[model samples]
Target: MQLPDKKFVPVMITPFNLKAKVDLDAVSRLVDFYLAAGVKGFFANCLSSEMYSISEDERLDLTRHIVRYVKGRAPIVATGSFGLTIEDKADFTQRIYDTGIDAVILITGHYANVDDDDDVLMRNFDRMLKLTGDIPLGLYECPAPYKRILSAPVFEKLVATNRFVYHKDTSIELEQVKAKLAIAKNDPNLEFYDAHTPNAMHSLQMGARGMSSISGNFYPEILVWMCNNASNPDKQEEVKWLQAELSAVDPAIHVAYPMSAKYFLRKRGLPVRTISRAHALELTPQQKQTLDEIYDRFTGWCDKLDITPVNVEELMKPLIHLDPPI
Candidate 1:
């Protein structure tokens, strides 16, 4: 359950072919891309991957492919909270864990309805823990279904279980983030990751293990740099500057996302098609223009920071044919 310090785990986006099927080849390339960008781990089959859009068998297949393709280069975790009941969720948890993932992540919304109190949520979580045995687990406050932001009390209670090891916090509010971190900051067994890009610097300073924001999907290298230097005394000025730059465009990258991310990566020369099952509509010219501008800014950041962005062309060299046609 222990990951490296200041890790940048990307909430992976699924790559689909023209027919909207999972493109395993593109997936392999994407893994290479993330690893080259210095990501410490991968959060596969999560919201960015369009978990709700893909079929149950596809989920297992996709996650299995990532686990096999990664080949233990970095730890991998995926969502396991699906189905109508806790028992059903527990069943899938075991199934996905069998796929060789380091841990099974449970969506907070799956445990209780939007209106349900924390007590109800805790009861279901306790039930899930009991049903699933000692399999490592994580929590994600997924926006879909309804984001169930855990209260500080609830988070402390869950941390006490010692069954949970990873937490992806989407509270967004710094106060709430600080409160939760106060409880988890001391737990070596738990690694807290902030999902809000704007809160990245503060959260990391306040003791977040690393970041797993959607921003990583666009420019993982920037996020990786931030994680590596967020708290360094010598880097505070640069960190402050980079934090402002990232916060300024946080909303821009989120517009038409997963698609925006695919478009951005395509601009970086990846083979990912701008096809997303979650977002069926195509990006408008305006959206594309905005992302293009962001792409320029991303390059400028890399130059100013002396971070050499990953060369997608070189990264894909092994996949290309170099022999001249006869």
Candidate 2:
């Protein structure tokens, strides 16, 4: 399957009602929200989705739900290989890939020992590839549980495979970003989505594909706007302004991830609840006040640029049929 060409693919959050079960209805609404916001594609079951905390059954069900709800509107990719052993992880990957996602994103270096060499990680990856067959693959330098930013040689080895096409380069260093983009250029099929928002403009200016981060969950239209216009010479000033605006969101919200994201979504009028079984971060009064202040700042920035903010109710109206439980 071909990777998504458009920029601003957001790593999606799995919404839950008060009970904290997989809220299928909220999932439908969230999918519609992302699509309406002009996201080029969807990363459904990634770290942002709380993959490490979700049950295997929930993962499968959620992936299938997202695939069906999206209905080919965009390319969907998921991370499902969370099992303890390589064989188990591959088995899970096969199951998630079967749910019609365009690609299965493997968490790079997830199975390696402490300070392990690249050879060990690559061998583990090779075993995963063998078990999953010809499924299109992507790589994520996911920082949770452990963060193994791929070494240049290791990443070069990964790119040599040719099958590992899409990469979520979470590294913040501009030099590292350049190196990965160089590797991406080597293969026509390879694409790198930068997950670090602080350097998104710099990375995009240097040929990185787009932005993928929890911050996108807050101001996706801002991301979409920046991605679409960053390359235009005339828009450099606006891009710089937007980059500064976008960079502030990560620091303000990282204090409480999916929880802050859910609260922001609710503020924007989506019917999602601020409930997270994964992180369970409580929103203190002080944090809530700070978030409100941030939201005001965000809207002011949007107003200045004429960027459209998505209407949650309008987006959800068409998804009424999906209100029933699966």
Candidate 3:
């Protein structure tokens, strides 16, 4: 599927009620929040969504729910590389694909073990491609299990297959991003997205399709602004300033993970509880304080940049779904 230029696809977080069950109501509101903030797509059931903590049934249920809620307003993608073997993974891939998602994302670490060489990974990936029968696919260098970064050569080979349409690159180094972008340019179908928030400006400037970073979970509109203005000649000064601000708070937001994100979103007045199956411990006083400070910074940036943050109140009003201009 073709995505618009400079899109900010949030790595969605799973909202759980007090009993730790998936709150479908809250999830619909979250989708509204993301769309209202100008997100182009959804990465449901991803690492940020605590994918490993939830059951297989929950994965399918949640992805299906998001697809239904989105109502074709935006394209959705979900992780499908769950089983122990390539054959099993391919089976699950098709199962998730049947949920009406645009593409099934394969975790790079799933096809091969942490110690496996690139050759072994390639063989397994080739086997998976053969078994899956022309299903559209994407690559995610997910940090879980292990981060098996794809080499430039391997990336080029995969691009040649003409199957991958999305790539979430976690190679934070700019040089590696540049190398991959060079190869990605040769294939018009593959849209490259960087998962690193700090690299947003540089990556977009270097021709990445957009960003799919965890930072969007906390403040999506800011990320959306970055995507829209990162490559503009007139926004360089503001872009550099905002990039520094995001880089400064990146580590702070990761202190408690999805819990931190949930808390931040609640602070923004969404119905999200600070409950996360991935993070068991409650946010410490200190952790909460840090997030509060980051929230202040977010407001300050919004004010300085003249970006109107999504109105949670207005978004909570009666839902009138309209397809995005994209």
Q: lDDT values of the candidates?
A: 0.93, 0.82, 0.93
Q: Per-residue CA lDDT of candidate 1, range 1-326, in tens?
A: 33237999999999998899998889999999999999999999999999999999999999999999999999999999998999999999999999999999999999999999888999999999999999999999999999999999899999999998999999999999999999997678898999999999999999999999999999999999999999888889999999999999999999999999999988888888888999989999999999989999999999999999999889988886232221
TM-score of every model? 0.96, 0.94, 0.96
Q: Candidate 3: what lDDT?
A: 0.93
- How high is the lDDT of residue 248 in model 3? 95
Off by over 4 Å in 3: 1-4, 318-326
Q: Give the poorly placed runs of model 2, Cα more than 4 Å off.
A: 1-5, 317-326
lDDT digits (tens) for residues 1-326 of candidate 2: 33224489999998886678889888888888888888988998888898877889999999999999999999889996678899888888889999999988988757686588778898988888788778889999888767888877788988897778689987788898888788787888877899988888887888877888778888888888877877778788988988887776668788888888888888887777778877766899888887888889889978998977887667766554323321
Candidate 3 residue-pair clash tally? 0
- lDDT string, candidate 3, 1-326, tens digits: 33236999999999987789998888999999999999999999999999999999999999999999999999999999999888899999999999999999999999888888999999999999999997899999999999989999999999999999999999999999999999999999898999999999999999999999999999999999999999888888999999999999999998889999999998888888888888999999999999989999999999999999999978876743331210
Cand. 2 Cα-lDDT: 0.82
Q: Backbone clashes per model, in order?
A: 0, 0, 0
Please tell me which predicted candidate would have the highest TM-score against the true structure: 1
RMSD of each: 3.4, 3.7, 4.7
- RMSD over all Cα atoms, model 1: 3.4
